[model samples]
Target: MTAAQPFVQEGPDWPGLRIFATTRAGGVSAAPYASFNLGAHVGDAPGAVAANRARLRALLPSDPLWLDQVHGTRVADADHEADPAPADAAVTRVPGRVLAIMTADCLPVVIAAPEAGVLAVAHAGWRGLAGGVLENAVAAMGVPPDAGLRAWIGPAIGPLAFEVGDEVRAAFARAAEPPAGAFVPTGGHDAAGAPKWLADLPALAEQRLRAAGVATVVRSNLCTVAGNDRFYSYRKEGVTGRFATLAWLVP
Candidate 1:
């Protein structure tokens, strides 16, 4: 598989930070995984995954600090850790150290406090988001809520494509002032008469970031399920590969 240029996600709002989220367009994996599958645990060939990482490393300062995400609120310190940690989020205040979060349908959030030399990447599926992964990640940065911080919400299952039952809706309702329009009724009911919903992962993420004191929040607008050719969507295909979102400071 050939190397596909990463979709770079950087802007003046996040100066001194270099960020990129991979697409499924480039690499060596075949068929279901196609190419550019960065996840090692997703049944893809180890060599293919390694080659893909090597290709990705060409554009980074160092290998990304990966995590074993458990859909929980644990946040790991990328700079101090020796190996992959069991956490949903990874943060680092050192330069040249990449913090990565793997996801297919789950929302990939990268938060940065450039002025403080801090960066964090989170894997936020419904369970993680509802359980306060974002809040824990922000708190781990050691910066005040009002600190000059910026966040970018990467692609995930979009609202129109994400159908959930009452339990999912109730979780967000439990949060403080869950953003309006974040969850829309699907005009359908479950077996228990509970209203079904099409949850907006990005909107929900933005709301969480705002509540955590992030001043500016931007979303990739790329939907994994919608852009099947460009992204790996686990919700769309049960047995599929996982792409990643990586972020680090410029040394």
Candidate 2:
């Protein structure tokens, strides 16, 4: 889609997938959510948000089915493909149907079953991931577990920078296929005699995808916690905005 340009573009490595991750640039949002903030719930002016959506519309193959993401594992049909729905993930077999997922520190995973002519996007924060969001998405596609799904993981908080509590750790462990290193003991030693253990959200996310048979994975390794100018982190900033990673087939 032809809205704000992507910091990274489609590479020769990615086949049968049109994907890009957003940066905090080229939009008209202001203040805490300053510029290019795709999320409307984060308190940006309605007009500016609409204009930003327009920019995204112009660039995508078709109107994107934006989600009212609640950080759950509920997969639903795309807005254009069905009705305006509430779901954390979306998949499509039809061409020109874009499956877009929004994220800041959380990982946004784009899936493509090239042979089956399908694509999907999942918004997986720790809550969703712990609740089987990715597995739900793969199941929603009805592609079978061995369909050779290709995935591209977008920017998110790195494990080293992400600090979580015991509750977050318990959530994953309770999940059927828990990812390892989701959280490390964050209370060893700091430069000034402090205590902390960092989490590796990206690595954990990759492990989840790999466990689900998504062999082809491409990750940007861009950390929202570290990159303030390019990304918006709710954890980093209590009142922050969100960027998006969108994917679709060219008609």
Candidate 3:
């Protein structure tokens, strides 16, 4: 197995805060789900996934509170919820309570309010983004969004690779006015001949976070589909494993 190379947070440093997202490197799963597959529900060997988690745990303060991501808006309270539940995002104020969100092509959004001692992570696909998952997570933190809250948009399918249909665009339009250039017409069509537009996942996420009043927003600018060798991308590989993004207060 290769050594794990996770993307560690570098800026807007807050005291006692730890945040990072894993790459596709390291661990011991075989092809398709090859090395470093942390997801248990993605058809990877159970033993392999367990081993991967164990490896990841060795680097964390405690076993992370993993969520059952449903591409919805539910936010789990990691400090109160002992068992994993069906939710797309999680929030915690207690130090050592590591919160995790698994994703491949979907965006992994990490939010922190150092002053309030709160941190949250969300799994945001187009559906969740348009459905207000970020908004919900920010609200769950109990800290005013405009009050020094910062967010990071982790790797996901970039705009050039994330082609979508009118329905997808309509969803964001129905929810809120998306950023002016969030969706750009590709002047192309899919197998069904439907018009396609490249949707910028990170841009959409940034817009939402800013609209929610987050004081600082940063994007990894890493494209999963484009950088599939280093990051898992379901959009690029149909049968693939997932990587995780985690955050916690340093204890």
Best by TM-score: 1
- State model 1's lDDT: 0.86
Candidate 3, lDDT over the whole model: 0.86
Clashing pairs in 1: 1-27
Instruction: Give the 10-residue window scoring lowest on summed lDDT in candidate 2.
Output: 4-13
TM match of model 3 to true structure: 0.93
lDDT of 1 at 130: 92
Q: How well is each residue in 1-251 modelled by candidate 2, as lDDT tens digits?
A: 65554343332245566888777788878888777888878778889888877776777788777888898888887734466567889988787787777877888888788877778889988888878888888777778767888787788887777886666666666754445555677666545654455677667677778788787777777778874468888888889777888887655
Model 1 C-alpha lDDT per residue in residues 1-251, reported as the tens digit of each score: 44466554443345788877888875888878878888899898999889888888888888888898899999998888958558999999889998888898999999999888899989999999999999999999999866798999987888789999989989888876568888889899999899999999899999899889999998888778874568888889887888888888887
lDDT agreement with native, every candidate: 0.86, 0.76, 0.86
For candidate 3, the 10 contiguous residues with the lowest summed lDDT are: 5-14
lDDT of 3 by residue, 148-239 (tens): 89998887899889989978988888867878888899998877887788898898898889889898898888888874578788878999
